[model samples]
Target: MTLKLELEQYPFVDLSAKVAEIIEDRFAIVLKSKLTLACMYLDPRFQCALDENEKKIAKSYLVKLHERMEIKRLAKLDASPDTDSRSNESDNSNTRDENENLLEKMLQSKCNQAKNSHQKKILQLLNEFDFQSERTPTGIDIIEFWTNNAASRLELAKLAAVLFAIPAAEVICERDFSTLNFVYNKLRNKLNDESLQCIMFIKSNEEIFQMQ
Candidate 1:
């Protein structure tokens, strides 16, 4: 009877270990997603969950995202009408004496140095251990925390806004499909592709329109 009971329990013990291993493997795969890891790092509650290498990956992803956003913003500014006026002013200003040209070069050099220092500050903040300290409160709201505390670090706040906006599950996609079924049913089957796309876009962003 003792041998039979051991045999009966053996499969259950083996299954439990397999289940644990599967769960660990799933987590490893999820953490391997660069955006997911970056989002976790941005959340103060989960900042300590990452290992050193994972932290490095998350930081690099965030910096790249920030740089991309900065590039887009600069492009928009360059395309604006004010930029044309500024360029004309700069062209005319180039006719100044040698002393003025030297002053302008010195000012540009200082601006470049300031910009480099700001970038260094951002990198230093990412590497700091203070955020992982026990003093960070439990159950803090990630969005609110970044909004209120990261004013000086607008790049981080912008990245957090984007990372947090990404849906972590399929519920949103499922909901959109459900909405599509209702919007494009048997009676509405004749809706053209362009019209349907416009409708879906409006539906997906209804909250923004409502706010306005």
Candidate 2:
């Protein structure tokens, strides 16, 4: 029979030369007669620059690289959760400790609260209280009486406690992001890869890049 027919029986031998034999087997007939069909239909200059084996090898490298990268991505994305779950255990432990300590503190605080409440009730009964009237004729007298006329007086001092602690916590962080938001809008789709990287670097580490 033909050389092809003889080689076909040696499947095991051809299997060793897998990619090469596959290309030859698939394209031999097409290369002979169908060449005229492909001559003007396909670009000959690009085709002639690389042979079948070279093209196959280049494609194989890219495919293998792509497969390796995809496998790495999937491994990162689809991996099973860590069985060593310390966060839940730590949270439960913190909660348990918090509950125990809170109960103890509340119990201690309750004793002090009862004592204070009893003292307050006794004071309320002793004082000539007028719930309808806003002003006490002797505001300082009641405070002084409560403190037993101490040298350092909370009532003698008119310290208006305004609860608010500052001229606002000057949060400059959000202001920077807001300013950057305007800049980012200007560069939505206009910028390429390099310019974006340069701008981000400059924004974060301006002193590092600039000398003067």
Candidate 3:
């Protein structure tokens, strides 16, 4: 759109049409990625740009990702040694105040019910999310929005974290390789593997150390 406006203002500009065509081609290739499409659907600012069918496809992909994460979470919990200890501790608490025990049981039941309907919970989240509402401020941080505002919805928040952690481009990886070139030059070729890794770690996180 910006290029289109520029062309309107100065139609004789050399290679303007070629530049616009290249940009459009790159965008078309990006749109073919399901991950990119899903991210757009999740981002409130651009969600409205997707049509109904695209939205449905994005939602399905998100649900599948969430379900996979949910399975891994449950598997970890089941494998934990603490589970047996906690159950034994709960049995020892049977002699506590009757009303308090009843309340705990009720809360546990509610949590179990919530865990059983992960799909339903996701549907509810989609239905209830309204970025146009007064509660959502403009220029909000997407990661912070999911982590803080949706803290109560653990499954959704975890899914968002996993999705957003994926790098959109290979720039970071390329930067790392560039850094390695400087660190492991011909003069420093004798550096051992462990020493090289240590230097890289400090170099990569120098900004973080400075902030502290």
Number of the predicted model whose TM-score against the real structure is largest: 3
* Candidate 2 residue-wise lDDT, 88-191, digit = tens: 76658877788879898997799678656644543332222212224334324333433453333321121101111112235645655665576578548676
Error of 2 at 191 (Å): 21
Who is ahead in TM-score, 1 or 3? 3
- Model 2 has a clash total of 0
Q: Give model 3's TM-score versus the native structure.
A: 0.65
lDDT value for model 2: 0.45
Check candidate 3 and list the clashing pairs. none
Report the C-alpha lDDT of model 3 over 1-212, residue by residue, as the tens digit.
46655655655666876776676788788877778777876677677767777777777788778877877888988885766666777666766567678989998898678765877778667655533332434488888877785657676677678888888789978888999999999999999999999999988889999999
lDDT of 1 by residue, 118-187 (tens): 6676677666633655545667888888889676766677778888888878999998999899999999
Candidate 2 colliding pairs: none
Query: Which stretches of candidate 3 lie above 4 Å from their native place?
Result: 1-11, 75-116, 130-138, 184-198
Q: Cα lDDT for residue 31, model 1?
A: 84
Report residue 53 deviation for candidate 3 (angstroms): 0.9
Estimated TM-score for each candidate? 0.64, 0.20, 0.65
Error of 3 at 160 (Å): 2.1
